[model samples]
Target: IQHALSGLGYAAVKGVRQGKFFVLNLDGWGREEAQKQLERISKEVLTNPVIEEYRFEIVD
Candidate 1:
């Protein structure tokens, strides 16, 4: 797809990436606690640090 895009004159298409997006809902947690738990979950459970990456956002 990157090559095809470039062929179609999208010269700025230097790379293409694919990944999953997730929306998680947590109940009754404060922002600081949510951030800490999310960091732990992302690092130890959700993704592999060697090849994969993850991020999370907390919303009301």
Candidate 2:
């Protein structure tokens, strides 16, 4: 998809990667707190730090 789009003149969108997605349900946490928790969870459990990488964003 990335190659096809780039071939069609998409300069702004490049290096597209496909990955998995997961939605966790948590309650009572604000943006700042949720961010910290997500970071910790992502680093410690969600990804293998050595071979894999992960990122998260709040959708709600």
Candidate 3:
């Protein structure tokens, strides 16, 4: 997951505990584009279908 985010240009800081959250400075892209890219990245790189399923909503 960290590698995937880095590949997308996010400067990710890995947590010492367990899970990681990426802090991204997404230039001037709108929320829709960000959400779309996140989904694509998660599916293609970060997640495994055999063990996980993802669902998301745009809050704004």
Instruction: Point to the candidate with the largest lDDT.
Output: 2
The best-first sequence of candidates by TM-score reads 1, 2, 3
Specify the highest-TM-score model's number. Answer: 1
**Residue 44 of model 1: what lDDT?**
89
Q: Which digits, one per residue and each the tens of the lDDT, describe model 2 over residues 1-60?
A: 898888899977968987887799989999899999999998888888898878887978
Q: Please give the lDDT score for candidate 2.
A: 0.87
Counting clashing residue pairs in each candidate, in order, gives: 0, 0, 0
lDDT of each: 0.86, 0.87, 0.66
TM-score for each model: 0.74, 0.63, 0.44
**Model 3 ranges with Cα > 4 A deviation:** 1-25, 55-60
- Residue-wise C-alpha lDDT for candidate 3, range 1-60, written one tens digit per residue: 677666778766553234434444566668989898878877787767577776555554
Ranking by lDDT: 2, 1, 3
- Residue 26 shift from truth in candidate 2, angstroms: 1.5
Worst 10 residues of 1 by lDDT: 20-29
Between 1 and 2, whose TM-score is larger?
A: 1
Tell me the lDDT of candidate 3.
0.66
Q: What local lDDT score does residue 25 receive in model 2, on the 0 to 100 scale?
A: 91
RMSD of 3: 12.6
